[model samples]
Every structure is written in structure tokens, then in C-alpha cells.
Target chain A: SQTIHQWPATLVQPVGSPLSLECTVEGTSNPNLYWYRQAAGRGLQLLFYSVGIGQISSEVPQNLSASRPQDRQFILSSKKLLLSDSGFYLCAWTGGYNSPLHFGNGTRLTVT
Target chain B: TQLLEQSPQFLSIQEGENLTVYCNSSSVFSSLQWYRQEPGEGPVLLVTVVTGGEVKKLKRLTFQFGDARKDSSLHITAAQPGDTGLYLCAGAFYNQGGKLIFGQGTELSVKP
Candidate 1:
């Protein structure tokens, strides 16, 4: 079975502070990873996706950035957090094109 | 950018009631997926419909993909309280590097 782990399940940070959310998957290799942000009533937006290590495609150009350091490890980072950056951040993985995405528990970030 | 639009942004129904949610798009998709997300968790893939006019069933939930591959629907039969969650629809344009675009989502509350 595949499992994804996301840490700092809940985060509260001051405005302009740095933010780092990590996610990793187990039981799969060379899987495509994605970063999504679900804002209040705004739907789930694709922030970034990576088909392989160091191959990240950003969907929305914002203060946030994503990196795939290892095959199954994806990190979402922000050098300076904004009030609008707070949302439910999700990490997902899939095997191939058009495959079903499996998601992690998610990180609830609150930038105050 | 390819986009998905979901109807009934919010739904509140009784436990024994039946409801239907829709996902519509102007562009055709190679595959469409339905996901359910709980309050503090990532969206979980409920079903993926690949073929045109394909229908898939999971317990009391039935998913149908439009023949044109531009839409999909989710029907819940005799919904239960446990079925309450945010329903999201995502589509994959296989030829477009398989990036998944998501709908705004429907927040369903099945009251008991």
C-alpha cells in the first residue's frame, strides 16, 4: 500500500516569515508528485507538479515554490509568507499520465 | 488553460436523500477523476473515469463520464452522514503533459 506523510500537520507563522512544508511517499518509485492549495471557496489550485526529480512545473507563479529533492520527497517552500498564502496545502502522487492521485493528510498553514 | 467547473458549490441534504453533482468543461479530457476531501485531510480519489461514456460505481456512489469527455457526474444514492465531504472533480488532458485541472468543488453536508 502507498502512504504519504506531510508534516507540521498544522502551522501558524507570522507574516513575512519563512514557510516550509514537506511531503514524502512510500511504496512507490518514480511517481509524479504534485502540490495543491485549497483556499476558502476558491477550489483546489495546482501550485506545482514534478514528473521527476528536479523537473518541476509551476502552475501559478507566486511566492511559493516546490522542489523534488528525492524520488518520493517533495517540499513546498516560501521565503516570505503572505496572508494570502494561508490555506490547506496538499501533496499528491500518481504513477503515470491520467493516473489517479493519492494524497497526503495535508498541512493547514495559517499566516498571521 | 483548461478548466473544470463544478455545480452546486454547497449542498446540504438529509441522510436518506439522493443528490447529484456535476463537473463540466468545454475542453475534452482524456480522463476525469472524482475526489472527496474531509475537513483537515487531503482529497482522496474516489473514482477515475477514463473512457467516454464510462460509468463506475463505488458502493452507493455512481460516476459517469460524458460521451464527449467534456463532463462528468456523481450520484449518491441514499446518502449517509459519513458521505459528507467536499467533492472535487479533476481532469487530465493526456496530450498536454497530463496536468490535472480541478474544479471549484462542492461541499456536501449529509445531515443525519
Candidate 2:
């Protein structure tokens, strides 16, 4: 079965610090990967999605960016974090356009 | 912009009670999906309804897609405490790759 792994499970960083969150999928190759952020137990905001390596579509232009270094490895990064950047970050993968998304456990980022 | 709206942003009900959550959209979609997420975890895909007016049941939970393919609903019969979670609805458009537009989400709490 396919599974997604994301880390660190929880993060606490001071404002203006650099951030890196990684996600990788196992049991699947060239799967579509997505990064989402949820604020205060509400809906999720799409950050970025990648169809293939080096190809990323950003939904909301903000302090964050995404990269697909390998087929199954995706990374979300930021040069400088803002207080508003803190949220529950989720990584998801899907086999195709119509397939249901499988998500990782998520990372709770707290920017103080 | 394509958007999804979910009703009853927060639901608190007792175990054994029946509740229904709705997701509505003005724009049509190729498919609709429902997900459930626990605290600090990524959303888990619960069900996907493709065809118009499609109805699918998972254990005590029932999902229905609107005839217009622009809306969907999830009904839980005799809800249990384990069923408490944040429920989200996502819609996918044809040709949008694997990107999904999510709703604001419905937070359900079933008290035992």
C-alpha cells in the first residue's frame, strides 16, 4: 500500500527563521504531490502541487515555496517565516487526476 | 474562482444521534470527495462520488452526490464518539490535473 511520510511531526521556530518540511511517498512512483495548510481547525488552503520533478504549481503566493527534487520527494520551504505561516501542514499524494488523495500525518508548525 | 462551501461549520451531537453535513458549489465538478481528519492529523479520504446522483455507504456513514454534480452530502446514522472529527469536502475538475478545491470544512464532535 502507498503511504506518505512528513516531518518533523511538530515544529517550533522563532519568527523570521528558515523552514523546511519534507514529504515523500512510498509504494508509488511519479505520483502527484500536494501541500496544504489548515488554520485553526478549519478548511485547508492549497499551497503547492507538483505533477513531476521540478514542476510545481503554487496556489497562493506567500512566504512559502515548494520543490519536487525526486519523483516521490517533495519539500516545502521558506526563507523567512511569518507569524501567519504557522499552521498544520499536510502532504498528500494521488495516483491520477480523479484518484482520491492519501495524506500524511501532518506537521504542526508554530512560529513564535 | 471555483469554490466549495460547507454548512454547519461546527457540529456537536451526542452519540447515537443522526446528523447530516452538506457541501455546496456553484461550479460543476467532475467528482466530489469527502474526508475526515482528527486533531493534528492530515485529512483522510473517506469516499468519492463520481456519477451524478451517486450514493455510497460506508459502514454507518452514507454519502450522496447531487444530481448536478455540484454538491454532496454526508449522513451519519447513530454516530459514535470515534466519528468525531473535522469533515471536509473537495471537488475536482476535469483537466485540473490532480488538484482539488476544498471547502471550509465541518468540525463534528460526537459526545458520548
Which of the numbered candidates is closest to the native, going by highest lDDT?
2
Error of 2 at A51 (Å): 0.4
Quote the lDDT for B91 in model 2: 93
lDDT string, candidate 2, B17-52, tens digits? 999999998888899999998897788889998999
Q: Alpha-carbon error at B96 in model 1, in Å?
A: 2.6
Per-residue lDDT of model 2, residues A28-57, tens digit only: 999999999999999999999999999999
* Per-prediction TM-score: 0.96, 0.97
lDDT of 2: 0.93
Model 2 interface RMSD, one decimal: 0.9
**Model 2 CA lDDT for position B71:** 89
TM-score attained by model 1: 0.96
Clashes of 2: 0
> Judged by DockQ cut-offs, is candidate 1 incorrect, acceptable, medium or high?
medium
Best by DockQ: 2
Q: Residue-wise lDDT of candidate 1 within A1-112, one digit each (tens)?
A: 8888999899999999999899999998999999999897447899999999999999987999999989999999999999999999989999998899988888888999
Worst 10 residues of 1 chain A by lDDT: A36-45
